[model samples]
Target chain A: MNQFIQELTKGLWKELPPFRLLLGLCPVLAVTKSASNGIGMGMAVLFVLTLSNMLISLVRNIIPSKVRIACFITISATLVVAVELLMQAYAYPLYLQLGIFVPLIVVNCIILGRAEAFAAKNPVHLAIADGLGMGLGFTMSLTFLGSIREILGAGTWFGYPVMWDGFQPFTIMVEAPGAFLCLGLTLAAMNYGTRRQLMKRNREGSEASASPCGGCRACSIGKSQD
Target chain B: MSVFEVFISAIFVNNIVLAQNLGNCPYLGCSKEKGVALGMGTSVIFVTVMATLCTWLVQKYILIPTGLEYLQTLVFILIIASLVQFVEMFLKKAIPPLYASLGIFLPLITTNCCVLGVTLLVQREQYDLMDALIYAFATGAGFLLALLLMAGVRERLETCRVPKAMAGTPIALIMAGIMSLSFMAFKGMV
Candidate 1:
């Protein structure tokens, strides 16, 4: 039980997909023009991830090592197709808004990375947990981006107006430029937080040590190894 | 309608990179180095042209004729993945040096949204085979051009002493914004 919690928690912050690792940004920037689009894309990804992970986990040991990547792609692609068909049938409007991204989900490094790293080695239940955790992390990032861009770019959230008419919406926020701005600022904020934490740790360490001179010895050893 | 318009629009007015915003994975990831960027650009041109032709046929004959158009995405992706594999293998045997430079990029192109996006747009626009091929090659060339320019700027950005917050991807994003705005100048060409 503890192990499952550890696996799930890692994806939320320690190994967040877009912000931290920067594995998948194509869809992150393209479809996040609105909050609804972001949530819709997130759900599609979640469904694909969970289904693909479970299947791959169930058949992990039987697959030969040489053809593992091919097998995984086929399985994942099949699930993506299934999801695409379901979306087309039930939610045509959202499906059309998503456009090519639904199919592009097959190439998303997040799903493929999770499959190669976790599902191919672990059991089905754990794979499901990993998928849910990672998918939610990705979804949360998209939703956050969507909210910011929608509020700033269109003066709306989920297609409803928020800002008064007098306020000028930054048109660039609705275009490709806005995508970059949102992504860059969000990543910089995260990096700044990490750097502050590192500084705090360094300060605490220095207070405990009698001399800062001795720390250079360890630093030099580490540098030499590099 | 004219070939010139197809070429011009694909290159500037409706650039795959700056306007449509496809092929961004390589645009941002591989644009740091000029030589590698050129190689990736050439590979995109090659694969995109071939894949567009192949997809045009499948869409016309197989998907539309038989009412399997809904399977377009799945079938198109499969065909593209296999075609990329075949091309990589053939090139490895035929031209070893060219293959080595472009081999790593071949696999990446299989999943590039620009390649698939062009193919789908060709179908969506109902272009003939010749036009599709031309548009695909032109768009790929545009992607290459954008990457090379970005590579040149990024090399120079290394020395510019940007800012604490907007150093890496942030600065790149801002640069992309500027590029998009510049490209907007050519919008009326269509």
Candidate 2:
């Protein structure tokens, strides 16, 4: 239980997918024109990520090391297809809004990255926790970014007008460039916060500050190779 | 649309990276060094065009005929994965020097949403074979163009003083945002 909570909370803030780990960025930049769209995309990803992680963890021992990646891709692709059908039937409008990004979720690095790094080694319950945590983190980040863009870009949040009548929307906030700029600035702010925290910890002469990459299993794997 | 117009629109008006927002992983990951960026761009061009051609045929002959259109995502991804593997093996044996330069990036291409995105886009737009091929090529070229420009800027960024918090990916992303804004100017050209 303790381990599960640890795994769960880590994804929430310590190893947040888009903002911190920087995985699965394509959809992050593309589908975030409004807060609702962000929630929609987040829900789809949450479904796939949680289920795929559970499935992969259950079969970890059966999968050959050499063929694991192909297996992972196949599993996620199937889930994404299920998501497409479900969205088409129930959420047709959002299906159209998200468009190619729905299918593109199959290639999202966060899903694949977690499958390879966390699920393949952990038990099913822990894997579920990790997936749930990561999925929620991803959804929160997307919604936050989307809300900022939508409120500023369209003078609305979740499609409701929030700004004064004469407020001029920064139309660029909803465009491709604004997505990049907003995300860039958000990441920088996060970094600033982390830096200040580290400095405060050091001034107290506490135990050495944890490495930013300490919680990032993916980067650790890459570093081990080098 | 005319072939010329499709080609121009793909490269400028609807650039795969700048306009469509696909393949950003490679756009940011590989653009730090000019040489790596060039290699990655070339390999993307080679794989995207080939994958488009093969997937187009598969969609026409197999998926459409069998009424398995619902399986489009699964089948396209499988085909692309296998296609990239074959291309990597063929390049390694037939063209050693080219393989040496592009070797590392080939496997990464399997997961690149750009290749799959282009194949799906052409089908969505109902482009004929010739138009599909040209569009795929032009899209790849646009990606290359964006990456090269970004690489040049990053190389220069190395010497400048950057804030501690915005030193690496943050600053690079802001730069990409600015570049994307400039690319928006081309919207009127086509």
Candidate 3:
């Protein structure tokens, strides 16, 4: 149980696919012109990831090593197809909006990366949790990016108007250039926060050591405690 | 559109790399050296042409006829993955120098969106066989052009003192944004 929580939580932040790990940016940038588009793409990825992870985890032991990658690709591709069909049937608008990105999701490194790295070695239940948690994390991150871009670029969220009258939106923010700007700024923000935490930890460690009677004495004490 | 027009338009008007913004992972990640970029471009051109032809055949003969368009994505990916493998082996056997140049990137081609994007775009536009082939080749040329230009710029960027915050991918991304903006000038050409 604890292990499941740990695996799932890691992908949300510590090993996030886009923001942290920077695994899959092609789709992240391409389909995030609108908030609804982001949500639509994210949900599709979540479904594909969770199912692929579970199935890959279950069959990890049975699959031969030489053929594992091909197997994983096949499984992931199958799930992507299933999701693509379901979306086309039920959400034709989003299906059209997402366009080729839906099919391209099959090649997304995050899903394949998770399957090969974590899911293949873990139990089915743990894989399931990790998949869902990571998927939701990816979805939320994209949706947040989309909301910012959509509202600023078009003065709207999704397709509806959100800004006050007389506001002139930045056209580039909603286009291909806008995608780069949003993603770059978001990455910088994440990097800045991470750097701050690292600096803070170092400061606290140094302060703790310096406050002691002696450096050697403190080091010895810490070692003994450990 | 005529075959020449399709070819010309793909190469300039609707370039996969510049206009469509597909396969950006390699564009940003690998476009540091001109030699590498050229090698990567050659590989992309080869794989994209083959993948498009393969998908075109599959779509025309199998998926559309069988009413299995939903499986198009799955089938395309499988074909691409295998085709990449075959190309890798063929390169190693026939041209070791080219193989060395394209070494690791050949495998990465599977995930490079430009290959898949070309396949998808060809299908979406419903191009005839000649049109599909021309578009695929021209799109590959466009991608190569963008990558080479990006690499040339990056080679010089290494010496210039960029802002500390925007030193790496951030600055590269900003440059890409500018490039994308410039590419917008060619939008009405079609």
Candidate 4:
């Protein structure tokens, strides 16, 4: 239970997909224009990630190492297609909004990265925990970013008017350029905060502040504690 | 639109990176150095054209005829994956210099959304063989242009001391935001 909890929490902050590892930026940037869209896309990713991770973990031993990448891509792509069909049938509005990005989820480096790195090595149950953690982390971040952009850029929150009419929205916040700027600022702030925490911990006899790693080294991901 | 207009529009007005957000991974990943950026750009162009052409043919003949348009995503990704692999091998054997320069980026192209995005867009827009070819070139060219610009800025940034808080991806992204804003000027040119 403790190990499962650890696997689940690791991807939340220690290895947040976009702000931390910087994988899967295309879908993050493209579909995160509104909170609803972000949630919709996030759920889609969660479905695909958790399922693919579980499936890959189950068959990890069977897949030949030589063609594992090809195998991973195929499995994920098929899952994405199924997700797309389900979305189209059930949630047509979101299905329309997401469009190509839904299909493009197959290529999201986060899924394949985990498949190769974590799932292929771990047992199925642990892989499920990791998948949920990463997927939910991705969801939270995307929704947060999307809501910020939507509120500032469109003067609304999830389509409801949040600001007074006199408030002139920074329309650029919703555009392509805005996506980059918003994400950049968030990353910078996160890195700065983590560095301060690291410094304080070092002062408290942690003695691990000799080198300030960006927390991006894949080998050391989810190692939040010394 | 004329081919020239299409080319210009693709390059500036509807940029693959900024406007369409098609290829942010490699745009940021490969933009650290100008030379590598160019190499990746050329490889993307080659693969985009090749992938677009092959997928376009398949969509028209195989998927559309059989009423399997829903399988476009699955099939296009497979085509793109194999296409990138084949192109990588071909470049390695035939054009070693280019291959050496490309390095890991060549294989990375397999999952690049831009390659698949181009094929999907071409199919969506229903471009003919010739127009699709031009579009493949234009989309790749546009991506290259954005990448080059970003690389030039990043190179200059390395010389100057950046603020501690905004170094790396943050500053790169802010720079991209400014560039995207500038590209917005070309909005109505087409």
lDDT: worst 10-residue window of model 3 chain A: A217-226
lDDT of 1 at B103: 90
Error of 1 at B73 (Å): 1.9
User: Which portions of model 3 show Cα errors greater than 4 Å?
Assistant: A200-226
Say which candidate scores most in DockQ. Answer: 2
Candidate 1 per-residue lDDT over residues B1-190, each given as its tens digit: 8999999999998888887767776787888789988988999999999899888988888888899887777787788888899999999999999998999888877767788788878887889998889999899999998999999998999899875555676677678778877888898878
Error of 1 at A2 (Å): 1.8
TM-score for candidate 1? 0.91
lDDT of 4 by residue, A80-157 (tens): 999989998899999989887888898898889889889999999999999999999999999999999999999999
What are the clashing pairs of model 4?
none
- Rank order (by DockQ, best first): 2, 4, 1, 3
Choose the strongest candidate by lDDT. Answer: 2
Candidate 3 on B14-37: residue-level lDDT in tens?
878666668877787778889888
Docking class of 4: medium
Stretches off by above 4 angstroms in model 1 are A206-226
Give the docking tier of candidate 1: acceptable
The top-ranked prediction according to TM-score is 2
Per-candidate TM-scores read: 0.91, 0.96, 0.91, 0.95
Evaluated on CA atoms against the true complex, candidate 4 attains a DockQ of: 0.55
Clash pairs detected, candidate 1: none
Residue B7's C-alpha lDDT in candidate 1?
Answer: 96
lDDT of 1 at A201: 68
